[model samples]
Target chain A: MTTETLTPEDERRFLDEILRRELTPSRSIAALLAGVLVVLLCVYFLLETILALFRLPGWLIDPDEALNWVAGLPGTGPGPVLALGGAVLAMVGFFFLVSALMPGRRARHSLPHPVLAVVVDDEVVASALARRARLAANVSPAQVMVTVARAQVLVNVRPTSGLRVTDDAVERAVTEELDAMGLSPRPSVTVHLASTGVVGA
Target chain B: MNGTPRGLNRFITGLLGLLLLLLGLGILLVSLVPPVAQAWRDFAAPLVRGLHGAYEATPLPAGSSWLYVVVAVVLLSVILLTIRWIAGQGQGRASLLVERPDHSATDGEVTISGNVAEQLLRAALSGRGDLLGLHVVTYQYRGITALRVRLFPRKGASPQKLVQDVESLLEGLDLMVGHHTPVLVHLGAGTRAMFTREERVR
Candidate 1:
């Protein structure tokens, strides 16, 4: 309708922003952990300082004593404790660094549409592929398994004892289904038929 | 689609990581090397002494130290700020979907609540067993109101069919509203979809 007034550039920008946010994983976990940690640290110091103002002993030690202990850590603290604490801190830092650097993409793919923007999760795609493959091979749902990866789809089928199922039929059906979906960066399809068929129907 | 400050989150995480990395490595180094330990002692001794001096000199009413009051206030503010930041995540859901001001009209304004779109779409898309659940949420993106329709597809449900069905429904909404509203259709397989057994009519 009135969306026709959107220029190509505007549409592209709109889709780009939406897709960028939709595909990337949110950093809520990291933020929450960091925020909680900071809050805890601040609370500890606040309590310690308040206690020291009235000349009361801190839960662990006096505020001044705690500082002296920390200041003395690099020089006189036990070697093993320093090493362990340092290693743990370094590992935590590396974890945060990795989380920030990685794109953290979710399992999703976008489909081309004339007017509407659509994205489907890879799990959903796998389920659809499994259905198609099972129907094409004339097998029960339990006999077929589908795994959808970032760039490939694998369909495994176990034919019934008396019936014969060809890989070509399953592959063709899966490919046609994928074509109909028109997912961007279309994943390649692989069909595998088990040599040993199940006994009975 | 919701307003989450992802970039800032990443930045804060990275900064925390760098700080921790340096602190860890510094401790590890100081503990393992005599020269580093000696250097740290030399640097810290003066700072420790200076802090002690400050604590003794600064006295407020009731024998409480001004230095302690200042430190406590600073830590309290830091805790407050962090709590505020943690509470601000995942906000920005718009209740008003559309609002237009027309000076020439008697009413001079046209408004549509977000509930209208959500109800209309939900009513139109209901009774589809292929979808385990559906949610319509409105968000403000770049000063324009946009809609995100999240569909939980049952196992073995065709996403292609789902996309086409939603597109036609959106077209219906556009005709009713007399203006185009941008929409993002997301079809996902949640736990409900995973646990749903396929129903077959024999």
Candidate 2:
């Protein structure tokens, strides 16, 4: 293998670039929209309180009064307002649950770490982590997800006897499959040499 | 419904506005006609308020006729929850949109999909001389009417020789089964490897 190795300097620069890429536009947009919704909701509630306290004729200040006050407001029937409000509330609740529970925050930003877990047969490695490092290990990452983006897998390879877990073999197997499909950056599923079982990284 | 977040959100905001307009118009129309049956104030007013609250999904504050606390709660809850969820999913899940002509000028099109680069880069980084220095990309090019022989080097391989090899590789495939498009093999870019200029049919 006489191939010239890319200098350590090059490697460092590349890794740094990865971090910057993680803060993608999609994340920003989502955050902004969420903030706007919350603010608008709060504003509405505050106004209702003030108006009610002063006893501003609630009937005169009906939905009609609110609409005319705004610029170029469309006069839609009541149906749409109810439906949209309900849907937004429901979606928010679901989002809150999943975000709170999921452990890996890497995917939360722009770190496209597509992960797959091939669980091996033993509990030895998982048990050890639980006992020593208090790293709650799952026998499975629950489910293995293969995304279109580049995802590197962290595997616990406890291959016993005669099986040489060379990086090339593993890399080859995964890359070949991805290539034939016209996918790139071929995913590198990391292999963790372990004693008993395997889990996701 | 599958509209981008921007479009979807705007549509929603528009809906709220529409509701306001209708409410306003309804009031103006009803006020135009005299208060039906002796200005029924107390009983009917409360009922209308209740119905409007349910209809708008914005529960006006208790004993308050203004659109205040209730609107805030609904909007705030939805925004925070939605944004937080989005924050979890990472940013920009939207597909990269490319504006390309329907008909490509190049013979056959070349497309490199997601995550494929990871593998190629890994191979390039592998320090394996034989793996083409990792930056070599393989693509199929078909052009107007013909066949030619050429060879090509692997990523790190000598380009002149690679072109020759590439030609032979194509010839073996017998892609020229008919009097048709030209088959050209050449290396594409973003290649970290050093290679001579592209070699083609002599």
Candidate 3:
């Protein structure tokens, strides 16, 4: 609810440095499944109607008749068989989609890499900033599990904290850290600002 | 739309019953036509009677593989029951999805103070659309610093639309900054925000 005025360039620079987590297998599956389902549903209904108009099912003799027609394959008609195969494939695809999706990772389960975290002197505010960054990164407080020692800060992030989100602000925080060292002697802060590495492998 | 599972089952059942009734009526209506009607009168009820008799007179007993038969039946039934469930899951969680990920922005907008302000300001500028002109309402001057962000509605946007957009953006930001892992990072924090502003120049 506060307003800290910003210059255009700092925002740009920080955005440039931002990183994002990748999609979880589960969520990606769920989303793709949903899209696929929509498409399949439409195609299925349309094709069913078209097939009916052509009387394809009727033209294909019953299994008993088909066997009598030529080679004896019981209860099989090419048109109907193709339709059955398509249906089975659709079902399998749907199953795989649901199985692979992980809603947790897709929904609310990503955090910035702990690598971005730094250990600062106990008196330094960098430690606190890192803590907030962890929180602001939505690293579950339980997951972050912060600790402090003699002039030191430690952070532990959960593995599920990967997947893309709006990382602009977090990157901004990093840019701020880079600038804090005054972008001086080789920009140690900015160089280190790219700590947005993956966590827990 | 937010019906409970039990309620949904009941609704679907009722819908199916209504559909069956309509279908039956439609068949009866068709049977009333001249040629179709004549045929229906001669055979429809008789066929129905035949179906009733044929239904139980022939038991589909599997030879020695009755256990396999039972298992197959059970599996089929389970698949039938769960099929709709799987289909429903595939249904939208849909509509529009906005993604904002930073936890800092979760409070609205991220504010910066002291030396970090300039860097943070740069990142904020990278925002798209209405995201551009975010005002960090406060910054840490001295002592303990806190960050807050204000989200603005896009031009002609509704409150619902704006909230959804902002929340999703936050979600996206959170995803972008964090890593994929089980054990957490940012562990062991030592400072709490003290009410006293170390330096409040404005």
Instruction: List TM-score per model, in order.
Output: 0.90, 0.23, 0.21
lDDT, each prediction: 0.83, 0.34, 0.34
Candidate 2 Cα outliers beyond 4 Å, as residue runs: A1-26, A59-91, A97-201, B1-202
Model 2 chain A worst lDDT run, 10 consecutive residues: A113-122
Model 3 spans with C-alpha error above 4 angstroms? A1-29, A47-201, B1-120, B123-202
Local accuracy of candidate 2 as per-residue lDDT tens digits, B1-202: 0113433333344444444445444444333334421243333556666655654664435544335555546655665665554444322222211112335566643322322333433433365342233222221211111121111122223332333444344343333321111222223222332343221222
Highest lDDT against the true fold, candidate? 1
- Evaluate every candidate with DockQ and list the scores: 0.58, 0.03, 0.02
> Model 1, B1-202: lDDT tens per residue?
7777888889988888889889899988888888987888788989999988987789787847888888888888889987887887887778776676656748657677778887987898788878788888887766667788999988888898888888888888878876677888999888898788764532
**Fnat of model 1, as a fraction:** 0.76
Proportion of true inter-chain contacts also present in candidate 2: 0.05
Please give the TM-score that candidate 2 achieves against the real structure: 0.23
Better of 2 and 3 by TM-score: 2
TM-score of chain B of each: 0.85, 0.25, 0.27
Residue B28 C-alpha lDDT in model 3: 38
